[model samples]
Target: MIETHSSSLKTDQMFINLGPQHPSTHGVLRLGITLDGEVIVKAEPDVGYLHRGTEKLCEVRGYHHCVVVTDRWDYVSAMTNNLVFCLAAEKLMGLEIPARANYLRVAMCELNRIASHLLFFGTYGIDIGAFTPFLHAFREREMVLDLFEMVCGARMTYNYIRLGGVMADAPPGWADKTSEFLKYFKTKLREYDDLLSFNPIFLDRTKKVGIITAEQALDWGLSGPNLRGSGVSYDVRKTFPYSIYDKLDFKVCVGEAGSCWDRYYVRMREMAESVKIVEQCLAALPSGDIMAKGVAKIPTPLPGEAYAHVEGARGDLGIYLVSDGTSCPYRLHVRAPSYINLAILQEALVGLRVADMIAVLGSIDIVLGEVDR
Candidate 1:
């Protein structure tokens, strides 16, 4: 480890770098923390290690080509990222997607949400010293990935959603496969609850650790389950009502106290809600053009700016595009929920034991791809 003197600190505080390779970091995230013995005096996050300059990459590429780059923002929920980017591009071009395509987007996005949450649940369990739950959660998540592969040709980094609609419609038996997975998912979630949720060990480790009040969370611009876990009922789907979200029936899971457990329970309950949304979307799926009409028209539109956001697995995934009446966007920006959500770590981890660090970070459900992008 390389130690550098900071001009911004008092000499009395023991400044330590907690990560860049620590197990609880989730990825290549480095935390510069000040320690007052076992308690953290203060914490400062050192980001940019994982920066890939995805936004800058967008400036040089056409609107259609940028969708693939969005997939890398949050690798776990590539579909959700695709949906946000495509929606924003469509808005800019003033394109109208088919009703069937809208329903498909909802179904795929909700399924991906559950899959992303399952990854967090698994990784959180491993971080908290329970390996079995991680495996169990992943086992279920793999089923969802299989569904993705069936619909899209690839699993991760799927640029499935196109400028006007999805790359393709659901394959044969897609609904049946998804329905079966959901059924098994319901049972597995119960097993997970019994295995981890009420366990004394988990509760003891997570209950009061990394506690952040609702006000602090809001002040920090936290979104998705992290904000909702803090007693906020604000959901992008409920508030913004994009795509088919307004037509779907689902509940936003919230927590009373913004602790690690609150975040965990919020995600746990959210899986059920996502499952509910998927079922409704699948059942109501109309048979029509899954791909939009006039997609081959090259998407050349009048220059304008548009922003579209979706309630992704993590939180609100937003895309901002400025068009110059050309094939490419003059400016493109993404509101990465993970990047913002991870900002609370320093505030949340202060005074907590090193052991609790992983639990807190995992509870936040951050994707390093988004954080570093």
Candidate 2:
């Protein structure tokens, strides 16, 4: 009774939801993924889980309160958020910020960029199955927070950068503490290199995975490290030169291949460039009042429209502000880089194995707050 049965196994594409709730996702984002076996056939990112209509909210709020709302957009790098809004508002009002104030603005924003990238470093390592790097990254990040708290009482959502200038000058001991942290952070960057940046296991998962060519990247409207990773030399700071960035000397970190690893390493190198910018600003910090003189408490700029963009930690963050000769803005629209950067994921994630989904997503380093805002 050696009877044999013949059967044909059929496979169909299976659709699965990744998350608006999954921990692997950087924030509250939903990815509708279709898989055949373990490979993704198609991917769609559905954002807006954390939406609060921040741009609409900004229209009704006063100029002072608008800065506060901008904090919620890219919550991790709030100083840059504060700076872009203030720059747009200041442009409308025709106010001249002091030399010292501009230097302080550059220093604060650069320090915040370091902190934000440290967060990405730690979390991306965890996403790729290395936990020890998380511990090391946070140890240095805490020092940056300590420096921020010394200037602005708040650690995260600093309403410190304002319309004409910063909230106040950094405290007497703040510069020395920041200088010491910068010295220490540079050494840690090397430590990070040995620990995770060049780790063999990390490379296996990231290198040459989810490759986006320079033309593809530009077509998808990618920016920040993602754009630079594709060998594009377009940095808003270098091209537009807002605030004191023109005066500061530093190199733009660019990468080749446009792989997940390239994007990740570009951010790592940019931290060093940011360190140089901060050090230069601190060394050349001028003597003057932190706030501009003769600015009204309730600033009512003339009827007009002004657009201001900055090189945020994520990318080109801009504010399109329209004033109707009122304290409240007539319209406020945000060009959030995270929202733009996240769009390429649909194409990038396809053909990648399920195991690599997290590595690619984590390398994009998006904060959903900005996407949803």
Candidate 1 lDDT by residue in tens digits, 65-172? 888899888999898899999988888777889988988888888888898888888888888889998888888888899999999978799888888888899999
lDDT of 2 by residue, 112-172 (tens): 9999999999999999999999999999999999998999888899999998899989999
Off by over 4 Å in 1: 1-12
lDDT of each: 0.87, 0.93
Give the Å shift of residue 55 in candidate 1: 0.7
**Candidate 2, residue 131: how far the Cα is off, in Å:** 0.4
- How many clashing pairs does model 2 include? 0
> Model 1, poorest ten-residue lDDT window?
5-14
Cα-based TM-score, every candidate: 0.95, 0.97
Q: In every candidate, how many clashes are there? A: 1, 0
